[model samples]
Target: MILALSFIESPIAVIVILGSILVFALYYFNKKQVILRKLSKTRRKAVASLKTNEFVKVHGKALHVVAPLVAPLSKRKCVFYTIKLEKKVSSGKSSYWKTIVDEEKMQDFFLEQNGSYVIVRPVPSPKNYKSYLVKDEKVSSGVFNDPTPEFKELLKTYNIDSEGFFGFNKTLRYEEGIIEVGEKITVAGIAKWKTLNEPIPEYAYSKIVELISDEKEKLIITDHPKALKDSRHSI
Candidate 1:
């Protein structure tokens, strides 16, 4: 208790903590600015205006091009997904959070607006751009020791280390950001039209395009583009 009080009362300690926070904020915003500049060059168009064999930028709710995959932790049907793993560490009298594992996975899906839909195919590559709001949902959290069978399987699939240097003493939390059934999303890429093998109703166009992007153009997905304050997705 004496040590804690002394640290809090010390002006040097307070300044150091505040300075660290400011540095982190500046770094984050600077990176965001670079991303905004790239997105600004993308062309925006309504989904209905989307034509076969053309590159276009559009925003709308996400839908399953096929049966949606069930998120392992949340058990929610989604078209796109991302997961994060964190570890807790302590040193001396101070404790803090450390992220040891960060991974993301996604699948082909459709972006729809005003009853019009376009197929986004082959998942995005490392070069294709994507981002999300900070408001991701937490699926589960607990100590890493004696992990559940499902958790173990997930760790194995992703090759994550549940055991630290000494033992499984770390706390594990699973959180995900998903493109759900009806949530809004934005995408920018080339739409390559292909004819369908079978007839389907509601789709006036018999051809569906496989979306792709070049170095300059990118594939972006987000629930609320307005919240990001980026004009690229808004347009």
Candidate 2:
């Protein structure tokens, strides 16, 4: 009698097994191309740009160069970043180089020029640290000009300081610009940028050495959140 009962329950067992298999299959499919799904409005622009421009493949924290690669770093890559100030940041901060020299060096990274803002280098940093200057493209200027009602509503929903937090404070700025996975794009519409002589490889650890921008409060941020925190505290 027990054996017969076990056989009768065997069908139910098979159905349960099949359900588990189906769930596992769904999970795998989603995991493979998860990035394409996760990106939001930025994806639309990246995808559309790919039609004319070239984009590198970016997924799983991996970046592979596209065709006509300019500068490829075999070990590491460098990228431009932006950071904002959570509080007032000081300019006269000592770096490791100054300590080794046994003297306090008050280096002004943001130069006080005549009607111009210049970015000086930080001490203990490589003299030729890879960085790029992004001159505003003609179209990029208008990209964020007319704020949509939805964008405004989101601002209200978050209850954030629209002026301070938004436009480009030294904080919450460009942490990094990994190629949007969906954007298999090229540099067709974009203009030439002043960057390092070589490209940084995907595996390399990069540090943002300096912040260069016409905007006073704006700065470049590195991918490492810890470094940004340290920069804020140190200065």
Candidate 3:
């Protein structure tokens, strides 16, 4: 009884717990500071011009792209999608979680302004401009149905334990990020000049359009309409 009680109240154990909490707090605070700084810079420099064949930064609503792909977890049609899969791990008297998958998939989409549009190729994320404005929705709140064949393949790829002697032992948590059609968005990048000879892909909504970025410049897409607050944090 004495050993158990001491273990429960050990000073080192207490310090470790407190230290972990402090570390997480610091990380959260730092992340917020960085995001705020980026937002401020974007707001200061963001433009709304829509002239073609010229490099510009703009923000507008997301337009249709490639018939809109269904988000894996949300089942909502969106141009851009990100999904995260986490697994529960158990240890003696303690448990923790590990991320098994964090992936983003997007089709070539357009950002539309007042009767004008730009083909956005959201490729080659910059080092400092990697934060995207997206909403995360919890699709699986720890409970899961029978794994689909695709999910089974993912399990094999990740080497995750799907079954034990009795039954499934692993708990899966699924969440997704979506940039839905008609949603307000912000974009920063170059507006490439489309050649008269070049033809827009048939999947695109329009043929007359300019590209967002080139090899020299990187593209950034965010849901912060005014670059003030990123809606992703609210979720």
Candidate 4:
């Protein structure tokens, strides 16, 4: 009997309390939603403006992102990350983030410790870098190529083997003495048939070196190309 009396007498108070809570929740959610939408818009615009080998700084890390986003995907508007990776981890191998971060709970990570990330655009050089492909023989070629005549000439001059085919392969950035002429290499990459594995008789280490050499020559020759490589290379 007493409970029935209390319910009837305070029905309006209960309604008012519920309404206030609902309003507060909606306002909080709406603010977050707006922030996320703006983030998505910015990312889309940034991606659209990206060049083949150029990367932009995002949440914040040094990621060599090959963009013009390969696959367009969407998540909550506040965050959308185009998938890029560190050297793919060996199954049992551990990386810096892998050790401290839970692979299974990536979202929770973004909510708290979003690091700054930068897309690493492939730099401009005169060489079409190839990966060493390894197939029946354990060697492969590079996934991407440079279509310059000078680049091709340098490869031929070095006697690099590019005959075998693969669908895709990756190469590292240009480095000094590490790239040697006449060095034999085994690589993995996609083939003409769209298969992503095969070894090329050649790799691009030497070619890239030669290309960098030629580029240096041109830079010494003038200020224009020099400025481009310098200013453009820097974020």
Over 4 Å off in model 1, which ranges?
1-43, 51-56, 92-96, 122-127, 139-170, 191-194, 197-201, 225-235
Order of all candidates by TM-score, from best down to worst? 1, 3, 2, 4
By summed lDDT, the worst window of 10 consecutive residues in model 2 runs over 97-106
Which has the better lDDT: candidate 1, or candidate 4? 1
Q: Write the per-residue lDDT of candidate 3 for residues 9-83, one digit (tens) a residue.
A: 798888999999999888767743554445545422222333454444556678875799777655678888877
Which candidate has the top score in lDDT? 1
Clashing residue pairs for model 3: none
Off by over 4 Å in 4: 1-9, 29-65, 72-235
Top-down lDDT ranking = 1, 3, 2, 4
Every candidate's lDDT? 0.65, 0.26, 0.62, 0.24
True-structure RMSD for candidate 2: 23.5
lDDT of 2 by residue, 87-150 (tens): 2233568322111111111122321212222123323242322222221111111123443344
Q: Which of candidates 1 and 2 reaches a greater TM-score? A: 1
Of the candidates numbered 1 and 2, which has the greater lDDT value? 1
Question: Model 4: how large is the Cα RMSD against the reference?
Answer: 23.7
lDDT for model 3, on a 0 to 1 scale?
0.62
**Per-residue lDDT of candidate 1, residues 67-91 (tens digit):** 8877666667887776777666678
Each prediction's RMSD over C-alphas, in Å, is 7.1, 23.5, 7.8, 23.7
